[model samples]
Target: MARAYGFVEYGGPETQQLFDTPVPSPGPGQLLVAVRAAGVNPADWKVRSGRRTGSVTVHFPAVLGREVAGVVEAAGPDTGFRPGDAVFGATAEGYGGYAEYTLVDARAAALVPESAPFEVAATLPVAAGTAFDIVEHLEIVDADTVLVLGAGGGVGSATTQLAHAAGAAVLGVTSAGKRELVESCGGMWIESGDGFDARVAATAERCGAVTAVVDLVGGDVLERAVALTRAPERVVSVADPARAEELGGSGITRRRTREVFEHVAALVERGVLTPRVERTFPLTEAGAALELVESGHAGGKIVVTVP
Candidate 1:
């Protein structure tokens, strides 16, 4: 039996619990991984709370977590991975990374380099990968001034760093507590909250017009961020796609390919991007790790380590 943390139904934190189940086996083109670490994101709790209704059906007692790093205990046919290989990627059969063992689609998985730890590699698949997609899709250039909403979180911080490295001037909107974190990523910190657009506008008056808005926070925050940019088409969001589309912007389309994983991993290995893991919890404390992310106060990434 494998120990896993998951929700019994679509509900709040009360729905989450730790339980035991048969160790999942890899199907064709999948790998059975002994999970080393799992990265916590807002999506996990959102999916659990039923805020993200979609075509995907939820099986009761569904395990959460999208990305993970671990050792390959078994590999399915034609997966190219061997037992004992270190790997990280999105889970295959449901986002079930919150388990002692889970399956990963080989196509989406990447071998972890010796230089990077499992905890750090675990964050690459979702957080860093999404940031890379946003930067590429927006065609962010050095001349561009990009406004990053929710700059203190995982995807936000990675997006800020990638945009900054691309030569774009970044105006990061976050809480005053994460001011240093935003600035350290080569962004000019703009405190987030009510009247956020005003502060952004004042900052843009000095930096230049915001050519693109990479929104990690949706709702009114995204609506306001869109107003700052002239090229609303260049505005992209990960948090609220429907609203983004309604506002003339679009949601990020992920390229769940091995190449993207490799590129992001390379950047991390080179120290050009940092995962900025704020906290880690053991498998038993997975709920606490997720609570931090769901609260929207997490400074960077929160990961769950399985022992």
Candidate 2:
């Protein structure tokens, strides 16, 4: 039996528990992976709380997590992976990364570069992948000024780095504690909170107008970001798609493919992108890890490592 953490029902953190289960078997186009690491995200908790069940239906005792990295233990037909091959990608539907073993769709999986560790590779499929989609969708250019709300978080930090690498000026809106982190990621730090829009406007005066806004924090924050840019079409929200659409902006549409994963992994290998893993918890501490991400204050990414 393999150890796993998951929710027994649709509810709060109280619904989560650790238990033992048989190692999952992979079917056609799937790979059973010995999960070395898993990246924690806000979406995990959202799904657990039943706030985001439209996309994926949860079974009772549903495991949590979407991205993972590890060595393949077995491969199903047409998967093209063998035992001991290092790989990472999104978990298969109804499967979760927060376990000793999980299944990944081969089409969405990529070989982990020798230079990239499992922890770093584990972060790509979701956070870095979403950032990539946002940058590509906006077609960020050197002349453009990009504003990243919640810049200190995983996706925000990745987006900031990618936009900066594309020669765009990046303004990262984050809490005061993450000023150093935002600046280190090649962004000009703009503190979030009351007068956030004013502060962003003041910075824009010096750095040029924000040509695009990447909203990782939605609701009023997204409203403020939309107002900062004249091209509302360039505004994209990963948090609240409905609100973004109402404001004339669209939501990020992910390209969850192996090619995208390979590209992001290559960036990590070349040191062009850093996963910036803030902390790692053991499998037993997965609950705390999710709580940190759900709190919306985690800097960079939180990973759960398995022994």
Candidate 3:
């Protein structure tokens, strides 16, 4: 039996617990992986809390975690992976990454680059992957001015770096504590709070007109961000699609492909992007890792490591 963390019902942190289960067997186009690291994202808890119930119907005793990096333990028919290959990507639905072993869809999976560590590769599937898609969708240019809301977090930080690498001037809205982190990634920091639009406008005057915004924070923040850009179509929100639609914008549409994974790995290898994993918790302490991500205060990415 493999040790794993999961929830028996839809609820809060209390719903998550550790248990023993038989190691999952991979079917066609799947791989059973000995998990080395798992990424913690707000979406994991959103699903656990039933916030996405209308869109996602999960069974009871659902394993919780979207992406993982590990060594392939077994491969199913039609999969390119073989035993002992180091790979990272999305986990199979219901059999997730917060465990000793999990199944990954071969189409969503890719081999980790030689220079990347398991922890860094672990962060790619969800956050970095979305960030890559967002940048591509925005079609940012060298003369464009980009604004990133909640820019200190995983997706936000990745967006900032990718935008900067594209030669766009990035203005990152974040807490005062993350100023250095945002600046280090070639973005200017804008304090997150009231009057965010005014600040964005002022920064645009100094840099260039705000051409696009990547919203990781939803609701009022996204509403304010819409005004900073030239057109609502240039404004995109990863956090709230409903509100974005109301404002003539839209949420990020992810294009998860092996090539997308390869692009992010290439960025890291070339030093154009960095996967900043702020902290790691042991698999037994997975609950603590989720708590940190759900609190909305942690910077960079939070990862769970299985020893």
Candidate 4:
């Protein structure tokens, strides 16, 4: 039997417990990864806390992690991967990853650099996918200025890097502590505080004009992004879809997921992008990882380690 993390109830991180289950097998166009690391995200804690509920229509055991990196243990005939290929990507339907072994769709999994550790590769997929998708699909022009809310988070950071690399002036809203990190991503920092709008305006003025905004923060912060967008059509929101729509911003859930996966895979391979995994916990301590994500204060990803 393989040890994995699952939750039968929704409350908080403490509800997560490890269980023994048979290892999963690869099916057609599928892969079985000997999970080395499973990165944590807000979605992990949100799902656990029942705060962002759904995907639980059927009553069955639920695997809490979605992104993973590992060596390919096996692949179905339709998949081109070899037994030893190092792969990283998101799991389908949020079923697994906090386990020693998990199944991933061949399309979702991409070959990663062998030199890179499992923990780092595992940090890709979700945030990078979301960031890459929105920035590419929106087609932010060279002269356009892009805004990223919650620049301190995983998705926000990735968006900042991808957009800046694409030639857009990135204005990132974040805490004072993350200024250096965001700057490294080529983003102009906007601290989240009383003068947040003024800061963004100043950055836009300095850049001559703003264009698209790939907003990762929700609530009032997202509203602030809506204010700086030079063109209404250039606005794309990765988080806070409801608020984004209310402010005439388009949603990125349509293309960013797949786009993020593809773009980040290339970036990680070419050494153009990097994922910061603040900490890693053993599979047995998956609950602690979720607790850190729940706090919404982790500087980088909190990954779950496996065999």
Report the number of the highest-lDDT candidate.
Answer: 2
Misplaced by over 4 Å in model 4 are 51-53, 56-60, 254-263
State TM-scores per candidate. 0.97, 0.98, 0.98, 0.91
Best by TM-score: 2
Colliding pairs, model 3: none
- Model 1 — which ten-residue stretch has the worst lDDT? 51-60
Better of 1 and 3 by TM-score: 3
Each prediction's whole-model lDDT (CA) = 0.91, 0.93, 0.90, 0.77
Give the range of the ten consecutive residues with the poorest summed lDDT in model 2: 52-61
Compared with the true structure, what per-residue lDDT tens digits does model 3 show for residues 73-168? Answer: 999999988999999999976677899999999889999978889999999999899999999998988988999999999998999999999999
- Supply candidate 3's per-residue lDDT for 139: 95
As a whole number from 0 to 100, the lDDT of residue 285 in candidate 1 is 96
User: 1-307 in candidate 4: lDDT tens per residue?
Assistant: 7888978787765567888868878889788888889988888767766766655321236678888988899888797788998888777554578888888887787777655688888888776777667777788666768877788888888878877777878888888988887898788988887779888887777785677777766777777667776576667776677677777877875342333465577787787777767788998888888888778787657889986
After superposition, which runs of candidate 2 have C-alpha atoms over 4 Å from their true positions? Answer: none
lDDT of 2 by residue, 183-270 (tens): 9999999999999999999999999999999999899999978988999999999988889999999998899999899899888888
Better of 1 and 2 by TM-score: 2
- Regions of candidate 1 where Cα sits further than 4 Å from its true position: none
lDDT of 1 by residue, 1-307 (tens): 9999999999899999999878988889999999999999888998899976684456778888989999999999999999999999999856489999999999999999668889988999999999999999999999999999999888989999999999999999999999999999999999999999999999899989999999888999999899988999998988888999999999999998888998988898888898888889999999999998888889989999999
Clashing pairs in 4: 129-260, 129-261
lDDT of 3: 0.90
Models ranked on TM-score: 2, 3, 1, 4
Model 3 Cα shift for residue 23 (angstroms): 0.5
